[model samples]
Target: MAYYTSNAEHPIDIVNIASLENRVKARMDRGAFGYIREGAEDEWTLRENTRAFNDLRIAPRVLQGIDHVDLSTSIFGIDLKTPIIEAPSAAHGLAHVKGEVDTAIGAAKAGTLFAMSTYGSTPVEEAAAAAPEAPQFFQLYMSKDDGFNEFLIKKAVKAGVKAIIMTVDSTLGGYREEDIVSHFQFPLPMPNLAAYSASDGVGKGISEIYAAAKQDFVPSDIAKVKDMSGLPVFVKGIQSPEDAIVAIQAGADGIWVSNHGGRQLDGGPASISVLPAIAKAVNHQVPVIFDSGVRRGQHVFKALASGADLVAIGRPVIYGLNLGGAEGVKSVFDHLNMELSITMQLAGTKTIEEIKKTTLL
Candidate 1:
């Protein structure tokens, strides 16, 4: 079988999205699970990301005679069945055997876009092939060498990605405490980015890789990427209004409000906390995408109501993938879409546009 189902020997109990996290924890080795579960120092931002959503109350507009609801939305001219995208996480090889490839397939089958990570174990071409029918986006890291950076941008364009998400945060990794405790390191090589070194394009030396990673990714790099590819460029990891405006001025086609899933700055504010101000700053000039601590459909609702054009799921996607691989990832989408629909109906929202700041109290 391409994917597996629950059985007596490998019993699974994923009645809800929250339970799926537990199920995956039971199934995977401790180190691998913590890598997906843990965040930065003290994890203050991580807890606050979700807590910010819970702090808000949805003011339902009852007695509306709405017959149906529409969840389909578009970003960067790409139509999505839902306003959800999978966030780009590194090294999915730890989650399942097929790694990021299976996650791409599941996202495609769910009527959404799958972001190909710059750190994925599978090559971008192979992942694109896995989901030929799905709209794909490429997340990139700007290398110190202008030549190498251009090489990666050109590669993603040649692979046929719809948009380029240039992650503005994590010019370096964060102080993830659990990772240190477990002594965890990525098991698989980053095949998608392996071609950016040497003449033969077979090896990316350790020193060369660190040099690229340590290089500062400034707003000028965003402009360079736009000039290099002429593709729609989205600046991810914009956590404040100032950063959002800087991205827009730098020619960002979209602004992704994120705190690197609370893995970068441990003391930084929640992505949701900064979302409203950033959205107001953009003021509909471009799409605003939100991610960091989205775990439920209600969180998605709060995001759109607060001014996010779309939401990207991170850990939950991995939770599902660990439990059932491709099939598990697909199930996660089903649960989210259904829950979102139900939430909308009860809130008297019949259209995605109807979800506005006024929808929340």
Candidate 2:
């Protein structure tokens, strides 16, 4: 029997997506594991992100005679093999030795997209170079300094990122009890920050680093980012209909529906719960991208049914990266694609278009 295992001596067998955490926990250190696992204060929204998916039931239409399922979809004129894409999560070096370089390689191998965070352990060019053919996006945390923001955006554009995903939810670090208790600080260099600051965050903590981010974000910032990068800009962290409309009106190419993976606000509604209204508000004027608490293929299906052109995974990719590096990240995407193919066939949907039309009970 062929099985996937990070360590041959330990022989940790590959299992379902939900099982990756506990398996990773057994091997990773306390602070590093906590950073990936724990969310905001009380973790109510964190837990609810997954729990709320149970509210929507998949009303599969049986016996439609669908044999082959097509998972291909296009975003911003770029084609992808699966609707599932990698979400931007900072500091992949905390999880794997290779960091986002491995992530970019894996996503490219899987024929999907990987959004690289501004705080990524690897520099934009190195990550983009890791998988030259891959469709990658840069997630920007606009710095308080205008020069730094313009410099970083131009650097990413030079590296060939297809779009800019401006994360609006996190102007500051969240009150993550786990990090506070564990006294967690990034152990490795954040070259992205170092490129401009001339410091690899030798002794500073994440909160201290976040202090340099721009606190006030106006709607015009959307157009500003686009003009800065000369690439399509997607306003991430949108949770309301009003915000969605504001973004589109401000020339946003897409509206990314996320609650910062439940890492920003503990009591806020789950990303899935708020997705419908935001999607309706955007009203297909721009693409709606979604993330947060997505573990199963059904969650991906439900999100598309609710009105998402694409769904991104954050923690799961890290889990895979921790366990198996580039191959592991590819495995994570491969498994989800397989599960989604099964869901499509069982639900009588043959294409991504059909899955979007699926009704959840």
Candidate 3:
């Protein structure tokens, strides 16, 4: 069963993601809000993630004579109605009553993908059932115990996940000052980690939970995950061209460029800053998934131009979920798609392929 008891009442006239975040901040408990809102020490990377995007300028062409725009694209053989998909974040119950179940439903409704975290408050099978038709993926935090790892792999496969997203970052928790000052602890159960007593991972700090995770996450684990699930494996949390190439050589079917939303490392380069080089390194050997500070349609446009095949969103979806549950989550995706379409039209790029061909200044 999923954690939590009731849903949040929908907010009125929430105009944008920023406004929605402010609304959540006003009403949510301090600790819960900070956990989602704050980043690692000094938070330079976190702040840079968006600032870097803001630095890039787009040059729109006017004479293409296009009438309609198409946002359709595919990854690992699964088609997406829009390039924006949900990046997995843990403990949705903290943001909403329905938790990951609501998130999955919202993403499904928007005709995009939702990747459920291993630390999700909802069980894998339950969330899967909530959105049976959605093309779902499982984001894994490999445990030190092989038995546990095998169990989760089998369970995710049984739930009909299309791919396995192995989060290569966060073998350990970052020095998040907010969490420490606030003494924040997960207030709800993480149903996915219920199998291990010590690792049940509720009511404890993130670092404590990470202590039970496998710290030796090497490139070979990419193939190991594929063998375990017999599905395509995406190595998420990649930020460098060198690591991107290594992941491909280790048989990764996809490269997910991220900085864990700057939650893991404080001084690292913004995920966007490193994407073009990493994409060049991969040279389209496999699909590239980019996420880390996407907030607008223009950000999506810039990422595609910079080399991302698809852009994944994190905090904005949670902001939506915090405000309106499944509907709120759907609203986030719909809004981004609307924005991306508008950007594409204004840029004279009618298709996603054309967006990829664009060059950012």
Candidate 4:
């Protein structure tokens, strides 16, 4: 049997999106993937990420008519059918052969946004083409070299990306203990742009090129990218109010509060715990996004009430891909939308705007 198919009698039954997590866990050994980070020493932040959401309770409203719901919302002027975006992670090829391409198709099918990572298995152009009509954001990793960074930004602009997400947390790799202990290999190899440049008689090393690209990067680099590509720009991995302030000042169109899934820093507060403060700091200048450990519809509601303009999911989609490829990804989003609809109906929210902080206790 194939790893993913629509057949009903497969060894792994994937009726629900959440079920795929267990199935993937059962089938794959822990050591197969990298980026899990290291030790319980830093896991405090990881635990807090989910626990912070749990600390809050929702105050459901009854007797309010909500037979219909509108989940649509706009991010950076592009309307998304839902308030969810696919959080970028490295190397989808490990989960399935179609890799990021399949993931993009799935996100489009679900009527959501897709964010492609710097280290995605497929090239950015290919992924973008796979989901032409879907809103797409290119996640950028600051290279040690500025020139290389410029190359990527320019290329992404030409590729029709709707936004550039500067990931600020991963200046260096995280201490994911699971990835370390398992010796998990990344599914894709690093881009060989430098090698190609060298072949063309450019003497710059990859790091040097990357540094040059970022050499002139200032607060306005956000504006420059937006002007160059006519796309919105966002800064991700923001943890502090001060940093959030800097991002907004730097011409960032949005702020994404993330601890890099607790993969970057182990002792940081859960992204959700700090989201309200971050949102407050932005003071409604721009939308604040939340991610880290969102696993349920209640978590989504809590994030929305806490002030997240949108929420992103990482591990859950990967789990789905591992279990059933494109169908698995579609199933996960369907389940989430269904759950969100039910939660909204129960909470008496007929539109996303109607879901307010008061909905949660």
Candidate 5:
């Protein structure tokens, strides 16, 4: 059977990433795609996430005479030419051998920020070196070892990482039924595990290693890293208004609202749909960013209208990497940028700030 069928326009050209996801699903092992959960276990939350967006109708304004567009924004004191940021994912090497290095370079060349995953095959320092001029944030995974967590944080900070993003939603791995059926395992093992266990000198004062392990590799508190490094901190995997408020109270500089691209927790509110409530809860105390189910410029626009200060792309870039490596990743960003510029022009908005709720329809 054919893995994919393409239109005359192009082989990769499809309506959106979701379509591409479906195409890939047909050829790949069952463990590769869809809600990780099995059976009828996920009926409500998974469906609700996508359905929430449908319930919202964009309210647009006409006759604004838009021209001279400016697409610039600042998040966590870092200026970005565009509001798009690359969402962190594990082992870009699975997508391509270049892994996070390709992603870092692509985001930097496109004049945006890149988030480096702790699970990436490329080391944080190496990824940072690839795009020394680009703004980079290190994503932290609380390890089963507290000492290891501290070591990773200190290493990231020493590597010139500007911000720390704590992924709190993944206390345990998601129930990916696809992986379960196919026995799909993460291609890259934790190479840093032994190094982290041996390094006791780092992150010493932050917390006792024994205390840290109790939380199952997730930090018991964000203050441990914040107080130790004094870098701006962001909390990812946020979904509810209460959690948003809690994150801000915990000294989060930003809240990255994501449902792990619907990979974890098979059913939940779509990241974009809950952005408004989360933003409202934060009340501008910090930036609220989004991920999951975003594929086009309009999706970015919708996110902004719904209160996302910035939006991130996850799977599309991965697909691009799978198809063409570094150049492919760059092409994905370029395509999105062009689409965004056109969307802004049509909405009668000239700049990022001009994209108000009225621009949506």
Candidate 6:
């Protein structure tokens, strides 16, 4: 069952992402809020994702003859007006009415990429239709049922998804005590599974896929997606340099450095902490996507300077959805775009390429 919650009693007065987050808290009940806010087990890695950013300070350059900053960039041939992309998050029903579809449309209006989660409440086809022109990626969960996984990919292709991000972490569900204590059951009527006409034999829904996938999931499976689907494929959940190497060797087109937002494993190294080595390991062979605990605009700047080709946001996007659906998300993106532009201007970096490790202290 899906935990569909209610919105706040009043309209949100957005000042920053934090304010949006507070609104989410005010709107959602204990279970709904805890589901998004809590991390796996003790949440050691969860806290670290943010603390790692605080540990680094930016060394700003002044009087370098930069009048304006341009945040335009591209990944996998998709042009982005800003360096930020909405990271994939599933079950938007807990946040808002429309769920992933709202975020997808908001991303289109904001001129950025949106990766629809495999567990999204809205079907990929319907969500893709929400923003027909936006560059969208289908985040894949390598189902125990190989054919079911392929069926999901085929749906993405038919829906004009730009790429496929196979999540390497989260093979098994996290030990989120928050959900257990709150008794938060997932909402019913999953559009993705409901729409999935997998006649090839299945139990019920995604649980079976996860059950079949406890030990057998591997990067070679990601390689197969690249080879067979012919789509630009990336491996998400690369936390270490060795993992990045393995992913590249397995023929991944890109590496997404994340700790599943510190939701999959507790007591793991922060996402940002492991990014520099992973970025260096890949050595520009493929785009390095970064995520986990990206809230403020300066956080986005930090990720770019550290080595992220593009920064994907998760919680903030969820907050925006809960705050005001598409409009809320647009506001979040706009604020991020402005923050990054200001950071570039203040730091004396005029373009995305100008953002490098040298930009940091």
For candidate 2, what is the lDDT?
0.89
Model 4's lDDT to the true fold? 0.72
- For residue 313, model 4's alpha carbon misses the true position, in angstroms, by 0.5
All candidates: TM-score: 0.91, 0.96, 0.96, 0.86, 0.83, 0.92
For model 2, give the 10-residue run with minimal summed lDDT: 1-10
Query: What would the per-residue lDDT of candidate 3 be over residues 176-239, giving only the tens digit for each residue?
Result: 9999998988888777788555456657787778888899987788888898999999999999
CA lDDT, candidate 2, residue 322:
84
Model 5: what TM-score? Answer: 0.83
RMSD in Å for model 5? 6.4
Off by over 4 Å in 2: 1-13
Worst 10 residues of 6 by lDDT: 198-207
Poorest 10 consecutive residues of model 5 by lDDT? Answer: 1-10
In candidate 3, position 289 carries an lDDT of 93
For candidate 4, give the lDDT of residue 182. 55
Question: Which lDDT values do the candidates have, in the order given?
Answer: 0.80, 0.89, 0.88, 0.72, 0.69, 0.81
Which regions of candidate 3 are displaced past 4 Å?
1-6, 9-14, 196-200
Worst 10 residues of 1 by lDDT: 1-10
RMSD of each: 3.8, 3.9, 2.1, 4.9, 6.4, 2.9
Model 4 regions lying over 4 Å from their true place: 1-19, 34-42, 191-230, 357-359
Backbone clash tally (model 2)? 0
lDDT of 4 by residue, 308-339 (tens): 88999997777766666767677777778778
Task: Give one digit per residue, the lDDT tens place, for model 6 in 149-263.
Answer: 7777898889999899988787787788887787665644556655664332222333443565535667678777886577989899889999889888888899999998888
